[model samples]
Target: MRYFLPSKRLGFLLLALLLCGFALNFFMQAASLNMDAMSVFSWIGEYYWLYLAGGLFFFFLLLVFSMILPSVYAGSAVAAVLCIVLGIVDYKKLSTTGEPLFPWDLMLLKNAGEMSHITKGMIPPLALAAAVLLIAAVVWLLFKLPKIKVSLPLRMLFAALSVAMITGFVSMVAHQSSLAVSMKYQNIFWNQKVNYKQNGLLFAFAGNLRQSLIEEPEGYSRRAIEEIAAKYSKLPDPVPNVQATQQPNILFMMDEAFFDPTRLPGLSFSEDPLKFIHEEESATPSGFLLSPEFGGNTANIEFEALTGMSMYFLNDGSIPYQQKIVKMSSLPSIVSILKERGYRALALHPYDETFYNRNRVYPILGFDAFTSEKDLDNAGRITPEGYISDKAAVQEALRELKASSDPAFLHLVTMQNHFPFTKGHNGPNTISVEGTSPSYKDELETYTQNTKLTDEALAYLQQELLTLDRPTIAVFWGDHLPALSAGIYTDAGWDSEPRLKHETKLVMLANFNIGKEPLNTLSPAFLGPTVFRLSGQPMPPYYKLLGKVQDEMPGLSKQVLIGSNGALTAFTPEQQQLLDDYRMVEYDLLEGENYSQDLLF
Candidate 1:
C-alpha cells in the first residue's frame, strides 16, 4: 500500500469534500439570522439526506468550475472563494438589514461603495472557524495536491459532462415542485426571512431561482386587460385636487433611510431631530406611506411612486428596475404624464447612477435627464460613509429647477441619511436612548444627526420653492427606515410589529395649498396621482384607475393593505374586484403584451 499510494490522495479528497459540505451549511446559516448553532445542527441532523443534497449540489458546481479552469486546484479555489465571499456579504446583510442577500443581489456588487459597511465586523464565529479550516485546505491544494495529467480529449469530455450534470440538477431543483415538496420547500413570498429559516440557505436560493422566472397572472389575456382599462377610464377622478393657478412644479424627494428615531419607545434627543419635517407634517397633508420594503430597497418604493403600480402584485423581492423595467418598450409613469404637459422631467440622485440600474431604467421611464453623483458639482461633499450629503443634493436639485423655466417634474433620491450607522460617524452624539446598550449609542447618534441634516435639507428646499414664485408642491418622505440593531424595534415598547416595520413618514407640502382632505397613510403608488391631482393636472386613464384603487385601498402592499377606513381589513367583494382590475392593468403594462397601452397610458 505504501509503494502504490503513500500520499493517501483518496482520503485527502474525501476529507476536503466533507469540509466543503459542512462549510456550505455554515455559510447558509450565517447568511440567515446567524441562526442558533444548536438549532441548525438539529435541523441538519433531522434532514440529513436533504442536507446531503445541498452538499452534492454545491459539489457539482465545483466540479463544473474545476473542469473549466486550467487547473482543478485553481478552479475549485475560485469557486470556493466566490461562495465564501457571497456568504460573507449575505451574513453582513442579514446582520444589519435582517434579510439574506439573494442571488439577484449579486448584481449589486458593481456598486461596491454602498457595500463597504458590510466589510466591517461581518464575519461571525462560525464563518471565522470555517475560514480557518478552509484556508488550510486551500494552502494544501496550492502546495501539495498533485495534479493528475489527463489527455486533452478526456479533459474536454469531463468538462462537458460536468456542465450537463450541473444544468440538469439545478433545473430539476428549480422546476420540479414535487422534488422541492418532498424536501419541504415552499414559496414564502411575503416573508423571505421565514422562507430562509424554513429551508436552509441552498434550498432557499434554489427556491428563489424558481421564483425569479416571472409568472403570468392567472387569466392574463390581452382582451382581459383592455376591458379592465376601459372600466377604470370611465370612473370619476378619485383624488380631484383644488385647482392651482398653474400646474405646480412638482419637487419630489424620496429621502434615504429616513425616519423619526424619537419614535423608538425609549429614544430621545437634546432637541427634535426632525424638527422641520415634524412642523411640515402638522401644517400640511401628512401621513405614513406603508412602504413595501423595510430597512433598504428604495427602488421598490421609487417604482411604486413613479408608476401607479404595487409590488404586491409581483413576485416578492423582485426589483423591477433590475429585472423588468428595461425589458419593456415604455411604461407609463408620472414622468410620462408631466412630460406631456410641457414639464422637463428630471431624476436626481446623490449616488451612483448605476447603483440600481437607474442610468438604464430612468431614461426608459420617461426622464428627460437623469443626474446622479458623478453629474453633481457637490458630489464630493459626502459623509464619513461616502454617501453624498442631502445639503449638496438639495443644492444641485434647486440649481436644476431654476435652470429650466418649464413646469418641472423633479424627483430627487437623497443618500445623506443612508445606512451603516457606525458609531462616532457624526463626531458627537446628539441623540440618547434610555434603555439601549452602550454598544447601540454610536449607531443611534449617527442615525439621528443624519436625519436632522435631512430636515435642514428640507428647509433649504422649501425656502427655494418660495423664492421661485412658481406654484410648487413637494412630496418628502423616507424611502425606508434605517436598518438599526436586530432587536431594536422589539426592545423598545413600540407597537411596530413586523408588518408595521414597512411604515415610513409621508409629508406633502407646497408653496401653495396642495390639499387638505387629510391625505392620511397611503402607499407610494398613490403619491403620483396625489401630486398630479395637487398640480391640477388631469391624469391619464391608468392613473384614474389607480386613483380609484387608492380610494378603496389607500395603503396597499403584499404585506398589509390599508382599507379606505384606515385600518387593516379583509378585502370586501368590491375591493377584490378593484384589485383584480389593478392587477390586470399592471401586468399588462409591465410584463404582458401591451393591449391596454393604447387605451390606458
Candidate 2:
C-alpha cells in the first residue's frame, strides 16, 4: 500500500492507463450504433500512434492538474467525468440527427427548449442509471485516493506545456498534416452522417471545428462580380403583352417532414395516405424534388428555394439564417422580385417566429409581413397538437389573398407534422405498416396519418383557390424527409441508396389550367425560376442563368447532378464557370456590396 500511495511514478502510470481506457470507451460509445465492440481494436490498429499520443498528452495534463489538487484520483476522475459526458452527448446527437456533434451545435444550447420533441426517449433508463452509478464510483475513488503535492512554479510550467501541446496538435490537424490524412476525408462538408460514421465522433467534431469559418469562393471580387453580371445579364423572354395576361397570385407551402413513405421498398400501408397528392400530380405539374438535406435542416432548403443558392457551395452545418443574413439590407429572393412587380409578399410560418431567426430574415427577404405562431394564435388559428395545422395555415392564407386586392405572394411553412411521431401524436393509427419491425409501426402510422391530413388540407386549399375570381398558383413541397429511427429504414431495406433517401415529392397546382408537362426533377434552388416560369413572369438574369443550367442539368445537389444527357458526370468547365458566377452573385447579394442588385432584382 505504501509503495503505491502518493508516489509520482505509480500515480502517473495509473493516470495514463486510465486515460487510454477512457478514450477507447468513448470511441466504443460513439461507434456503438454502427460498429461492434471489437472494432476498437481495428481503429487502434489503424491509428495506434495517434491514439497513443492523444492518451499520453491527456495523461500528462491530468498529472499536472493532480499536482495542484489534493489527490491524483481527483484530477483523473474530473477528466473521466468530462469525457463520459461528452461521449453521452455525442451518442445522443448521432442518434437524433444522424450526425456527430459539431462545435457549432454548442452555440445552440439555448434552444434546448425546442429540442424536446426530437430528443424525447433518446437516452434509455438503463443507460441513465449506469451513467449515474459510474459517476458515483468515480467520485468515491477520487476521495479514497491519497493526496500529492508539487511546487507552484513546477505546476505552472507543466500547465503551460500542456496548453502548448494541445495547441500544436489542433494546428497540425487543421493544416491537414499527413498525420491527419485519415481525418481529412471525414471532415468533408457534403455528407456529415457518412463522415461521422467513418471517423469517430471526436475526430469528426475537431475537423468540423477547424472548418467552421466560411471560406470565400474563388474569384470573389467586385471586378469578377461586374464581369459575371455583364456576361450573363440577358433577361429571360418576357411574357407576351396581351389583354389576357395577368399576374397570378403565388403561394408556396413548405411542409415539414412530409414525405411519401410509399417510396420505401418492401414497405406497405393499409391505405394510400397520399391519394389526393396522386390525383393532383395526375392533373398538374408534379415530380420528385432532390432536396439538399436529409432528415433535418429545414432552413437550408428554404434558403436554397428563396434565394436560388445551393447549400453545396456553403460550409457544412452552416445556418445562413442565423449566420449570414445578419444586417444585410437586401437578399436575392423570389419574394423581392415579386414585390418589385406589384405583389404583396408575405411570409407565414405557424411555429416559433424566432426558431430560425425568420422574424428578421423575412424582412430582409423582402416580405411585407411575417406571420408566425403568435400571429396565428391571435388570429384564432390553433390546432389540437398546439401547432397550427396546414388547414388552419391555408385558411389564413386564403383570408389574406381575399383581403388584399393586389396579387399576393405568400410563403407558408407548415409545422403540423414536425417529428417525434411516437404514439398518440397523430391520433389513432389509420395506416398499418408491413414488412417493417413492429417497433416502427406506430411511428409510420403517425407519419402517414399526418401526411394524409396535410394532403386533405392541400386539396381543400386548391379547391378554395379555384373558387376565387383571380388566378392563383400553389406550389407545395416537403422540406426534407422525416428523421425516422434507423431501424425503420434498415428493416425496410432502403438504407443502401442515399439518392432514394433524399428524394421528396413536389407539386405545382394552379386554379387556371397550365401545361401538363412533368417537372421531372429539380433542386430547391431552381424552384424560384420554375415558379416564375409557371406564372408567366419574366425571370432576372441570375434566374435566367439558373434556368439555362437547369436546361442542361435538371437536378443539382452536392451528391449528384443529372445532366441533359441523362447521365451523372463531373461538372464540366462550362458548368463550373456557370456555378462560379452564380456563387459570386449570391455572395455579392448576401455578404458583399450588393453589386448585382440591378441584375438580380
Best by TM-score: 1
RMSD of each: 3.6, 4.7
Q: Candidate 2: which stretches are off by over 4 Å?
A: 1-29, 32-35, 56-85, 92-98, 132-172, 175-200, 210-220, 238-246, 326-330, 378-386, 400-406, 467-470, 565-567, 570-577, 587-594
Q: Give a tens-digit lDDT track for model 2, residues 1-601.
A: 3332344755565556556655645463345334455666666566565456556555555555554565556765666566656666766656655656666566556667766654566667798898889888877766675545545665566567767876776666556577677533335655666665555555555566666324667768778877776666755454522223778889999999888988887877788899889887977889878887777779888998898887767776677877668457668688888888899998888777777778888999899998887776554323354456778888988888888799999999888778767666656767787877777778788888888888988889888988887888889999888888887877666677666767788998888776666887778898888877777777677888778778777778776577777646688888877777777776677667777887555
Candidate 1 residue runs with Cα over 4 Å from true position: 1-15, 22-30, 45-49, 117-137, 144-154, 177-191, 210-215, 380-385, 424-427, 431-435, 494-496, 515-517
Query: Each prediction's TM-score against the native?
Result: 0.90, 0.83
The alpha-carbon deviation from the true structure for residue 393 of candidate 2, after best TM-score superposition, in angstroms, is 2.9
Q: Lowest-lDDT window of 10 residues in candidate 1?
A: 1-10
Please provide, for model 1 over 206-272, each residue's C-alpha lDDT reduced to its tens digit, 9 standing for 90 to 100.
6677564245678999778878877877876644567666767888899988877777776667788
Model 2 TM-score on a 0 to 1 scale: 0.83
TM-score of 1: 0.90
